[model samples]
Target: MKIQLQTLYNEYLNIKWKRGLSPVHTEPFEYGLYEDDSADLFLSGHSEATFTNWMSELRPEDPYYGSKPNGMPVLADIFNQLDVYDELVLYYLLFTLNTTMSIHTHNSYSEMNDWMKNYSFFQLAQLNGLSSLNDEQKGELRDFFFFFYLYTHPVNEETLYACSFREQDLIHTKTNIKLEHYFSAFHDHYSENRDKYGEQFLIAPHEIQACEQLTLELLRIIEGKSPKLSMPSEEGLEAVVDLINNVEQMLQMYAKNRTLVFDVMRNFLADPRTGLYRNHCFTMLLQNYASYILYFNFDEIHALVNDFRDTPAWCGIIINKIFTDAIFIHKIMRKNAIDIREYPNVIEFFDEQAREFCL
Candidate 1:
């Protein structure tokens, strides 16, 4: 049965998003597989742009190049599009503790939405008319130590964590992780240091090719059994390895996916290749996703780590690095003269989160 709108809104608070229609709390359900069922009504009445052409339903000017049911105009699907939803979902994740888009910041998520609807076009005009500076000035603007940290200081560092990603194929390929090699290394280390660390390393396949297994066993185990859920390394040992693997995967994806890579490249190219932002951005972004991806990974990890509350320190070294990289992105966007501020929610999110994840 189709769920009611109010009911869905309540469910969103619980991080319950619908499949196909919604862009709600999604995770690494099964590697590359992804789905969300949020009804388009969550964003009802927020559609002001009146874009008929951008809809997914319409045919491109050339039928040979573009075609079919996806060709149908999705005028109502603006907020439903992946790119648009990525921004909001990222925004939802950054500011609030809960996974869903709340009614207000602290006072109310619902009130915030109501207030935003009345936000004037005149105010938007004021923001859009601003001029751009050269790269140096942009760099200054993106500084966390200067802009954000000054804005929210004395929060001091917390625990650290390292999150990483790798495709199963790369683990066996020329990339960083060789297949099964990590398990072996971790096993040897744990075996030798049994007196110092009582932890046991475990391994699982990234891709379970058994179509019969998902419904039959994995669900029962995850839902019924308590699994280990810590960062896996306190000294940045395995975490560092995962970090390296994750970075390699991002680079690989960048090399393979020219569109997104070039979007970043063009942003970087806007400025002179001298600043810290331009130099190691690949590393910077690698660090960012490593932490953010954890949004989806943390609960599973938490369930796994439920038994080990006082385990070794957990600091997100990678999370902090992501902040710096994001600042660089915002700086470059400013330097290159993009109207990113119009997307305040996105800018604000990157601004608020960049340095704060220093754990």
Candidate 2:
């Protein structure tokens, strides 16, 4: 809820009453102080002596306290006027739900179909602002107060952590699957207008510089060394240096081999022989690239490519091998009559997650 001084004051008064403090005069301030303690009003009004003189007989610690008039106003009466506080609380709660609902947020809003009746807290808040908060706003406050908790609290909350009131119908698109196409189109357009780009072809020199740093880092990670430029051993160092030299030579060799490089990428995606190698590489490449964007460093991708390329073939081989192993494992386990579906929560959540990702 949007924090406000008025509500804070009301809550503060509530806490005071709970602590057994006197919050109000036996009569309204309109009548001023009671006749018995009339002189105690302004002489340091908050002093212990001030409280003692006015309420000393009713004091809980007094020797004969039970006989006193017990002249304090009830907490329920002071707290009964809380429309302003309730409205502010509901608005803040709804505001939190408006964020973190994901792209599927619009899929379940219909559940709040009675939002117009119960959730007019948000509406009236927008219309009249807090100025309309008074005895008249009580009906609106009571209706919407509970729903502020209901709709925003996720269904199957053991799975979802954030507060997200879902919308009625969620529309899914192949956004992630299409990222490759978009990035490739951008690269192609950039390549076509190299003259216009002038200093922007960003080839040759960048490849050389990036390769130098990337190779040293890759060698360190490949050998499981710390992040540094030092090559620890002569034998391993020579192999590392040679790999860099071959990669540079291959770059020059492939200068006119755009067709070959692209064919490699396409096959890498399609898994011409089997899908496991390509899938593993896909995970490695994707995780590395995602981390690179966030961290703005080559360490992640460089380490990923290093470890991923350790097999006989690069990306395509690992993906195929992993998938083959997974399928074999599944079949053998099934033959023994042990079903993975026995773990219902894991199975269901993963199935739904797969559907969502594929969607």
Candidate 3:
């Protein structure tokens, strides 16, 4: 992917060079009061003239100011030297900064506005002639920018520490098996069948019964109705038990207090510094997963999921992972139990799954 991205970037640069439109250096100017506030405000109105003015305003005394050349020509030249992944990281960092600044500025002044309708990073990129990216590259870029935004924003870090039990819900929904049972069965099935089957397996009656018995024992341990399993540590029984307990706790919390779920989620999702843009955008995405436990608008859940999955952000990465995992687990279950036929190897299975499930 990095190699492909580099090739695409080179092609883009070649197009620019052939047109004799390489970025040029200009004299610096004073940017006035815009420097005191969000840089997005200045950048939104950016022209070669504005960029020059903004660069001129940089002061030696400013703690954040570095000695790197601030002109576009110099910056473009620097970009040419970076590896594709490094270039993406640098571009996404800038994107997050601008997005954060823009969201903060919008929230301060517009008490009731739909910023999503007004703002878009994709549009901004296209306007700047940055349209060389393929869908996969765009997804990676969104994920990178989102994580950058999430970690940098000022919120109680603890709010972000919740166990993501959505994966369990996904497994249950897709496979029609409880998560505990699924994991136990999957572990046993993988151990016994992996080498023999080479990605194709048939379920014997004994294997099914053994899996059921193991699942029951796991449930007993998780429920505190029995002592810990005596299995070898390599089997990861302890880790499975821990996961079950954490997910159980999360479910209990959701069942006991719906408002608490929203409140904690709001702390993570509602912050303007994270660039969710609109209140509804946050509410919509939260509703997709939260609505399974809480009573909220259900009509838009699929649309919301699609929206989040399409957007290039941390939320999208998360949604994609959750659904992708569910699909993978479902495939595994089908292969081991029901299919009873030779299937595509694991790599092919994943490639097919990615095409079906991922953005």
lDDT tens digits, residues 1-359, model 2?
12122232222223322223334332101112333322221112223222112212311232223564443322113333323322223223222222211111123343222222212222222212223234344333322322332344432232122221112111112111121222233234334443554542334332223222322322222122322122111221232222222323323323454334323333454444433222323333232122111122222223323444433244433323222322222322343454444533223323333333322
Task: Report the lDDT of model 2 for residue 322.
Answer: 24
Per-prediction TM-score, please? 0.17, 0.15, 0.20
Q: Give the higher-TM-score candidate: 2 or 3.
A: 3
The list of candidate 3 runs beyond 4 A from truth reads 1-85, 103-253, 257-359
Tens digits of per-residue lDDT for model 1 on 1-359?
Answer: 22122233333333321112334432212111113322222222223211111112212232224342234221223223323222222222112111122222223443322222211101111111113233343233223212222122111122000111131121212223322332233224333443553222111122111211222222111111212111112221333223332433433443465244334433433434353222333343333332222222322222212322222211122223334533433433444465543533323333345434321
Alpha-carbon error at 200 in model 3, in Å?
A: 61
Candidate with better lDDT, 1 vs 3: 3
Superposition error at 59 for model 3 (Å): 20
**Ten residues in a row with the worst lDDT in model 2?**
168-177
- Would you list the C-alpha lDDT of every candidate in the order shown? 0.27, 0.28, 0.30
Q: Which has the better TM-score: candidate 1, or candidate 3?
A: 3
Clashing pairs in 3: 142-312
For residue 121, model 2's alpha carbon misses the true position, in angstroms, by 51
Question: Distance from true position, residue 96, model 1, in Å?
Answer: 12
Specify the highest-TM-score model's number: 3
